[model samples]
Target: MDDLEKAETVLQALKTAEQQPPQAALPILNGLAGLVQGDPDAPLEVQEVRADVFMAICELGKALHRGQPAEALWAPALTAAKRWRGLLG
Candidate 1:
């Protein structure tokens, strides 16, 4: 998915994680993580996106590790992701 779509998916996943299974959200995170890890020769801007994605994953992991609410995690992550997406546009 594109940046906007990925940001939207992550935000939505955060919002309804209680109602939707982890099955739904985990894959989106996993996919974004995979993309972030992939493609070394990407443009500088895209590399920045990878950095944002990595940070987002770190936030999510940190929240899960701390047993804290995801509000703190996804808010910034979504902002970064959406900003990255906007740059792409």
Candidate 2:
């Protein structure tokens, strides 16, 4: 409901998506982006990590859609998700 609550939800989603398919991370990233919307007071780190997540999701999708192996995206996606979670703390 509030910024902290939204951040926590984003953290949980990021954590869960870390070990799942990158596709599973897309909705979570999108949700977090929407949550961060209008949050002009959000920390700079939060904004940066949200942007990272958005970029990572796009890259992951592109790789997957191009018939590349899902494993190729997993590590980077997990790393970015972890970074996003840490930045929120």
Local distance difference test scores for all models: 0.60, 0.61
Write model 1 residue lDDT over 1-89, tens digit each, in one string: 75556545555544454344345555555555654453567578777875876788677755555566665566667666666556555
- Which candidate number has the best TM-score? 1
Any residue pairs clashing in model 2, and if so which?
Answer: none
How many steric overlaps are in each model, in order? 0, 0
Candidates' TM-scores?
0.58, 0.56
Looking at model 2, residue 74 earns an lDDT score of: 57
